[model samples]
Target: MRTTMKLDGADLLDLARGAAFLGTGGGGDPYVGRLMVQQCLDDGLTVEVIDPLDVPDDALVIPTAMMGAPTVLVEKIPSGEEAIASLRALEAHFGRRAFATMPIEIGGINSTIPLVVGARLGLPIVDADGMGRAFPELQMETFGVYGISGSPLCVTNEYGDSALIHGRDNKMMEWLARGAAIRMGGCAYIAEYGMSGADMKRTSIRNTLTLAMRIGRCLREAKDRHENPFDALLRLLPDTPYSYGRIIFKGKIVDMRRETRAGFSVGRARIEGLEGWDGLMEIEIQNENLIARLDGQVRAIVPDLICIMDSETAEPITTEQLRFGQRVTVLSVAVPAIMRSPEALDVFGPKGFGLTEPFTPIESIV
Candidate 1:
């Protein structure tokens, strides 16, 4: 049976933490999103999450998210209405009121921003998302992989500026949105990849929101009980599509190279293995952790998730936050089944990121 859940302030906090871990070192930071949701809850707003199956088959579903460099989002916070404005613009263009809202990704700020928009618009949020984890490009979403067009996208900035693009395909949508975001001062709110409820149920990574919440709750409860939070996280993985998790490396950040370029935080990071392991690891970043190498061998790659967390606290560290000399544990999780399909891989696989090495599942590697 399908079930629904209401999100309170406490739930938002847990959601943020879980989303950060799932972000795989991208999706922007969740701090701004948490603050926004907290303010909404303080005002007594009700944010309800509905199972994708519970949505009417013909209902119009709009997926909303932030587009641009993660670092830029930190410096320029939203006006709280950018998403709403984009949604309204889409509603006008489609000539139909949205029946519900869903996150484009269930990671970092993108996860919580949808909740805020749902609360403000009095709309139910689908308990699913486009990317099971965070990805950098618009065409990387499951919606795009499943043949949903991202055209007629509406983008808005904090200063009340908005742009609507009618693209031929999802790739075109990404190019247009990237250029538009750069023009709008590096960050913008986007409402795109609109689909019907039936299509959403078929294309979305189901129950990702609940998965994130459970991960967060497990970590929090583990800490409360003075148990290992990483162990708690591993225990919960079997219940989700991400059935595997492993700490592939433990090290201290020795170097990081990152810059906000062309609307993306792009660079690499190097870490030296600590505590008697004289190995080194390297990570490629483009808004999110894309690839990781240990001792000159590829350990993880994009479309799969590579997360770096505080070794002791288990808190996720974003790509932009990687600092010199901070102890960290790098973990990798297998992408969901839907993302492993031949077509899905074509869009998010190693080649999609311009890597010569072929895509390999994290499970097979670890």
Candidate 2:
């Protein structure tokens, strides 16, 4: 049976909160995306999400996302004109009207940006996304890993200018798009990796949008009930394929070094143990938290998740917003089984980020 969920302004808040958590301290803040989708509601546009399984096998499905610094994505909100323009450019080039739009990742603004595009174009947003969470590079996606090409990519900026790129390979597409994003003032909206509904079911991560909303709702409800939000998370994630999650380290951020390089917020953060949690914890960031080390031993690495959240409220903190002296709890979650496959790991595992260590699940280490 095919089911659909109609989204409203309030749903976006919950979705944003969940997306932030999944982002693992990157994906840009969801504030801008929330407002953008809210405006779509305010305009009386219908925003609907359909199950990936429900999409007809022959239906044309397009994925949309932002490219460039996660910091830039959060700060610079643009009108819907560019997003719509990008998708239109894709339609023109491919000569196929899209049956739906989906997020390439379920983190920060990218998750909700697709809703704005879908609402404007009268296309339902698919409940699935490529990366269950956020990753730095364009090619670090299940779609790309499984052999879907991101060519015929359309990128648009706030200036109403757009570029259409057809790369020989997805990695090359990523390189070209990264350069384009840099030239488009550090960020731009993209509609790429156009595929059939069947391709989506086979290659994309499933149901992350709804999962994000459920996570957001869990936090909000826990707070309203005066419950431990972290406890709420542990209870909620297991029901889904994420399988296991826990607070790995709790402390205050004592040191952070971040810089904008190659269109990414690249840095490392050191958190001094506090609240009786012994040893120091550190996280390597490139748009997203890639790895965490506790007292020199690898605790969690990429292909898993290393999320930093406010200890008291469980509110996720993005990398660019990290500051010294902020009390935090680092939550590590095991990624889906599909993402841990050898093929998937080769593209986004520890080595993909230049770390020589092998990929290890948080479930085993923490």
Candidate 3:
């Protein structure tokens, strides 16, 4: 089915919450994205979401995102032109106008940056993305997994400087882009994985924007009705690509360490279990929560989503936002089918992140 949806102010607010949740402790903060979208809405611009099926097979589609440490994004806010600049640079290199823009990942700011660019350029945004959840590097995208080359990648910083990287594969592109971001100030806007609409329809994670909105709306409504937000989330899980999820732990952060290094927010958090529970739960993170261990036993690992939320409000806490003594609840959701395949696993599995344990599906673990 082909459908076109419009996001208004209220919808964007819900989307911000859901996108942040889906970020799984990465993708940068959705708060900044929400502000950007709100400003666009206030300026009378419209954001249109198009189903991938609606795009012409021959049409050019570009995925745009912010690359580098999420913490850096908080201080060095984008000038809004960076994303557009990257897209324009890519167009110049490819010699074709982009038919539309889409998110590289439907998590946090990356999810909304494309919408901002699409509105500015008066183009539709395909309701799909490269990664259903956020990943640390460019090569971790499903597009890369499916053999899409990330050549002619474009990167731009807030100061209006832009660079185009070519003659390299996706993995090399990540390294080059990361170094550029570090040199430019630790964060930059990137546009890569350009492809034909047909290729995107085949490789992209479909309808994730709608999924994030649905999740945000569910949590909001649950709070308004004084219902348990956790139960609301669980009830809605079956309808999304991630059909299984559970609160793996509830505790207060007792120890945490984080630093922005090599364009990534790398850190670990230790939580003291509460409510009659004993021992501690530790989470390893690199931009996103990669793994969780309960008293040294693997409970959840990357390729699956390990999410942390405020214990009271159910709002997601990004890796950079984790603070000592803050009560939190950890949740794990099964990743989309496309991301769980053996091919996809090689790019984001436990071993890929230097963990010794073999990747186990969250469903199998819990």
> Which candidate leads the pack in lDDT?
3
Candidate 3's residue-wise lDDT over 218-296, tens digit each? Answer: 9999999999998999999998889999989999999999998888999999999997667899999999999999989
User: Candidate 1 residues 1-366, lDDT tens each?
Assistant: 576898887788788889999999889888889999888888999889999999998999998889899999888988569999999999999999999999999889999888889999999999999999999999999999999999889999988899999878889989999999999999899999888999999999998888888888888999999999988887788778998888788899999889999899999889999866669999999899988999889999888889999998998888878898899989898878999999999998889889888888888894
Give TM-scores for every candidate, taking all chains together and pairing residue i with residue i. Answer: 0.98, 0.98, 0.98
Model 2: weakest 10-residue lDDT segment is: 71-80
In angstroms, how far off is 103's CA in candidate 1? 0.4
Error of 2 at 44 (Å): 0.8
RMSD of each: 1.0, 1.0, 1.0
Model 2, residue pairs in steric clash: none
The alpha-carbon deviation from the true structure for residue 165 of candidate 1, after best TM-score superposition, in angstroms, is 0.5
- Ten contiguous residues with the weakest lDDT in model 1: 1-10
Count of steric clashes across candidates, in order:
0, 0, 0
